[model samples]
Target: MAAQLSEIEVKGVKIPLIYEKSTLMPAVNLQIVFTHAGSITDEIPGLASLSARIFNEGTKTLGSVEFAKELENRAISLSVGSGNETLVFDMSALKSEYLEGLRLTRELLRQPNFTKEALSKVKTDIKASLLRKESDFDYVAQVELHRRLFEGTPLEYPSMGNRESIEKITLKEVEEFWKKRGVLRRAIVLVGGDVELEEVKKDLLSLLSVLPLGEEGELVRYEAKGDLEVKSVIKNTQQAYIYFGSPFSVKNLREDSYKAKVAAFVLGSSGFGSRMMEEIRVKRGLAYSAYWRISLSKSVNYSLGYLQTKLENEQQAIGVVRELIEEFLQKGITEKELEGAKQFLLGSEPLRNETLSQRLSSAFSAYYRGLPLDFAKEELHKIEALTLEEINAYIKEHQELLQLSFSVVTAPKE
Candidate 1:
């Protein structure tokens, strides 16, 4: 059974909580998700992610190293990371230490000591990481796809920001940025393990009430437009990275969204048996890995496919990908293929929720999207009842998949 999701109001803020008392293990997993607190809402590029990273450094009452020691001493694993739309602080520890976990969460969220010294060190580390990402062909390729696909929009830049932006950001600016955006006006807390509903709710309410209420902010939503074109960056490398996709708009729980998932799987996302992998990599020996993905954020949703090949065969590889997409559009998935894809997607749900952290994350995701606790199962049933005809019709309706914007990173020909 799914956890019972409830909401509590703390000083006019609505905080959502999940109660799951599964004695499956002796551990407790807590996920604290703050909506609209990630890169998607960045006033300054990378500020959302950078500010999130700074939270783990220490609180006003504890230094960075001591803070680290305390969490380690309790065998608690705490992580702070951000996606495009939300900031997440995930904690996993024994059921016996749940109170301490909540206390530490409160400390970090309420009194993060973003000292100049810590800020300087973090900036230096992130700058170095950004520098390294430049040499990563796959990373560069993925980022470039977003850059071109979402050009002139807020979503275009990488979450880490550019060197110029990071260089200009000051410690004072990050503190202010955090102050403005870090308020948990909508706190979605999920707890899974051996714990009572009332106990967890009380603990979360007290800790979360410390978060001040702030006004909501806006972010630029990206809408893809225009003709079929390939944007290539010339480099002096042997491998070429390519990604192509069309901008797709679908809501979280819409019927059409489920069909979209089936389409994605049949096209390329489904591993070695997928269309892109079979035709591009296995049949023709064109690329090493071929895959497609559908990314849905609160503001924007799109479907993209990626492959990497030798620089010599980059254009050929791109052409092949376009051809396969056209064929799939003209001739949608076969009955066998449809069933196989459905099984793969459905069966994969277990692995997705196999761990406590995974369950917490999924619950957080569901809550973030205003979905019910059993959304994954709900979608699985939807997928089970879908027909090939309906799926194909949806694909035909969105035939602009042929107009995928290709972003390629490869060396210029001699």
Candidate 2:
């Protein structure tokens, strides 16, 4: 079943609600999403992420362990996390324990465990995780790529922040960030599975009653740099980790999004059958696998892809990738490639919406992107009717993606 969209007013704030009722599973999942409150809005690198981490530490009154135990006793799952563009609180429980789950969520939001001890512990853990990632060449390359693409913007920083940034985060800053950003004005509530709309609105009112109507912030879209620069990191690894990105200029996000999907699939995102995989891996054996995708979002738009290969073949692999992309822009995809992409995308549509949560996520995404709730179905129709000429024209139009920049992690000169 599809998710339905509606609105509910609390404290004179109208919040959009996405809901789907299903009785097949005796459980429910709710997500409280805060827009323009994620890493993109962080004043200090990782403030949004640290704020989410603190929120997950449970209530001030109960503390982390006891608060977790209370939820564990009822087999409920609740978590808070931040991504590039939004912060989310997710909760899931059996229908019988839904209200109890909501109770804990409210408590967590109203009385977060923002104590000094919790802040120190979370910072230490994040630092340790960052230390471990030092050895992860893939992570190193990916971060470096973003650093180059969005050098002066908030997107340049890793979502989890760096060691220095995390160390500089104080408990007071996290508290301030949450108090200002986590407001009713920025929230969109999503509920699905075994619940009625009236019940959901009542539960949400009770859960959100504690939040203040803080000022809403505007989201700034960062442009990807198109300087065609190459940055390399010297590491002790035998295999080279190479990541690449460039500007994906789409003038209209909504009208061109479906065409971009089909183009992305045939060019790189569809794995073995895609252009990148066919040329880089199967054709020349440059790497075991390679991938690329068009990341179109509210805050940023770019093309990102990565691959790994032996140190000796790193330059050749990079050249082949560049040539492949240039050729793709020049010649576009074959009719066979277009048909294969359409078949796979259309055929796999069912699996994508097989669950209530998936449907809810889709509905929320539509709302977030300013599209109709039925956009998923409409997108399928567009994909099905897409012509080869139209797709090729779309591909040839975005030659800006050829201004590729590379981030490579490889061994030092022998």
Q: Rate the local accuracy (lDDT) of all candidates.
A: 0.80, 0.91
For residues 1-414, what per-residue lDDT tens digits would candidate 1 score against the true structure? 466778777777777787677788788888887777778777677887788778878786897899999999999988788878778888888888878988898898888878887888778888999999888877887788888877777578898887777777888888887777667664577888888787777777788878888766655567765358898877777888887877776643456667888988888888898999999989999998899877775678788888889877888998998898889888888999989988988998768987666666676667656777667778889899999888888777767667688888888778
The TM-scores, one per candidate, come to 0.95, 0.99
For candidate 2, the lDDT comes to 0.91
Q: CA shift at 393, candidate 1, in angstroms?
A: 0.6
Give me the displacement of residue 209 in model 2, in angstroms: 0.9
Show the colliding residue pairs in model 2: none
Kindly give the stretch of ten consecutive residues in candidate 1 with the minimal lDDT sum: 218-227
Residues 201-237 of candidate 2 have per-residue lDDT tens digits of 9889999988998877898988999778778999999
